[model samples]
Target: MTNFDKILEVAQKRQGQSQPLKLQDSTVLLEQIKNREQDTRPLNLKHIESLAESIAVLGLIEPLVLDNKARLLAGGHRLAAIQLLKEQQADKYLHHFPDNRIPIRMLPFDAESEPDLALQVEIAENEQRRDYTPNEVKAIAERLRTAGFIDVKGRPKKGQKPLMPALAVVIGKNLRTVQRYLEPNQNTEQEKSTTPVVLLKQASTKLKQWQKIEPKTPQEKALAKRLPELLNLIEDVLSNEK
Candidate 1:
């Protein structure tokens, strides 16, 4: 069958015991979604906006499947995107029907537990998506820990990294990076900052020197710190300092 058909079939199967759809004000639903347990990687605004625009134009092509208890079994961001589209409520043209929240589509979930189902959605969405930065992957890893028995060690106690190797592979980085990000005090224990919260205060005086450069992503931001080439680049770029 077609992709839409496949998505519908999947939605129907997921919401087996629940009703076909509900246009309930899903704000509470979403808040519960945030608190309940699930994962989302660091998203560059560019990508989310693109997806939002597509939903804005095409309508929510896929229905968000909710559990028997009204918990989301899948389509977390898809629902978020749809809500944003409805809020924007711009007069964009789709195949037709287009007046905001628009009763898009919903399917009930007959899942066993919220975490069990949420994890399935998390993996499904992640498998079909792009790579994330070390920082972003850490976010996902953190969520998985709290997302229920998905962990062999039971729920992680927060700020803990998985001892498992397979998870590291999914985030597209080695396990060490995962640990480094999850380390509880990393942000507060900035060794560089403590020696001086504001280093080379005078060095930053040359606004133009810093203004022209940008670190591409977390990796680039990091490599710039540890890479010798970047040290040379920094020296060259900041040469204008008085």
Candidate 2:
């Protein structure tokens, strides 16, 4: 079993709830879960848009999971997508929010008594998410290091170990991969500084190529549409750098 599954098993055992509990209110508004965004994962607009479109047609299959206080334990991105879909379809002839009510499984642990368990829940949820960008992996590793999580032997753990292996296990990456992401750039201080002239020239050439592509996918089409706006933003950044 995955670490997440193991942690979840432990949590279920502790709470004495073998079965999932549904949120009591049938008409619980999406606004109830709104304004709570302490999740670690950054919102990916493309992902959200795609998911929202899918859920609009098919409906939510997996119910959201939430802590006892109604704070979201998982499904922050899904919630955001639901909100997006609601707004987009507000003017549609037969549209309503994805459902008349959202379903959620309640987490039995009290946040104050089992704070560590609560954090484990968050970690478990994010573990099943999309692969982190290299930069994101780096930030995660740094955060883990800052939090003083190291192997029992005082070095990076071997193979696919848990908490001790830190981000590697959490993100399902190898120890070497995690270490590589954590490694400092070899670039010198002078080499690290970038000039917008360099960036502008690169952006200009890429923009030319991207402008030529017959975008087939929604993502490609979005990129094609945004390329000009991106160039303009680059120009602003370049001007500001001056």
Candidate 3:
């Protein structure tokens, strides 16, 4: 089973009731978070617009998951889309909030800490279904590392902490992969000063991956030739550090 499946299985086993719980917005949930609720995934305007349009037309088919207090543990953009849809439809509709109240499937974090549980819930959700991006994973990894979490072997670095196992699962990568971003050179003695080396390696690997072209094919050859320049340009633009 996928790592995500494992998490759901755990949840299902621990479930107080077979059916999921539901709550009203007026319900007071505990608030222990220090981080602002924003899209760490960085949704583009085009995507947001598309989502808003889709939600407005079809309604949000799935409810966003939340930690008891209605603090979003996930589905930032989706909630935004739903909000946008309701806002535009509000005049034609109701008093408080419009469309279907944006349905949700609650999975409360019984863990001690909000930060850890939030990351855990996010990871489990990602693993259970799908909605994680590499950038988002990287950002989470950076946060965990900053909080002094250590890798499996306990190697450490500045601005790099170990990700809790659950979040790594949602990323669909191993703890090591998460740690690679956390500390790309954690144990490497010879190459400690390599800046963005992991990114460089990923870029190189991507470029080399495009070399699998059929020489007899016209389009393949053209694509292959452009790969190097494409990689260079992308790297240059991305690495500007502006």
Top candidate (TM-score): 2
Q: Which portions of model 2 miss their true places by more than 4 Å?
A: 1-27, 34-37, 91-99, 126-242
Q: What residue pairs clash in candidate 2, if any at all? A: none
CA lDDT, every model vs. true structure: 0.47, 0.61, 0.52
- For all the candidates, what are their Cα RMSDs to the real structure? 19.1, 19.8, 18.1
**Model 2 Cα lDDT, one tens digit per residue, 1-242:** 76555665676777787774333323345767643446666777856765565455445544566666777767766777777877786532125344446766666655556667666777776565556556666565455555454445554455422333545544546777667655567223223454557757687788888799799999989988888888888778778877
Writing each residue's lDDT as its tens digit, candidate 3 over 70-188 gives 56766665666655655676642233234344456554544333465566666656556544444555565555455454455455455553345534533445666655644544435
Candidate 1 local Cα displacement, residue 203, angstroms: 71
- Each model's total of backbone clashes: 2, 0, 5
Q: Could you say which candidate leads in lDDT? A: 2
Better of 1 and 3 by TM-score: 3
> How does each model score on TM-score?
0.32, 0.41, 0.37
lDDT of 1 by residue, 1-242 (tens): 43333444556566573533332333233333322244465434444444455544334444555544655555655655554554565454222233222332232444444355445554564455444544554555554445331344655676544333434534434656656656776656555464431444434444335545787889867755555554455566556453
**What ranking of all candidate models by TM-score puts the best one first?**
2, 3, 1
List runs of model 1 lying over 4 Å from the truth. 1-37, 40-44, 93-114, 125-242
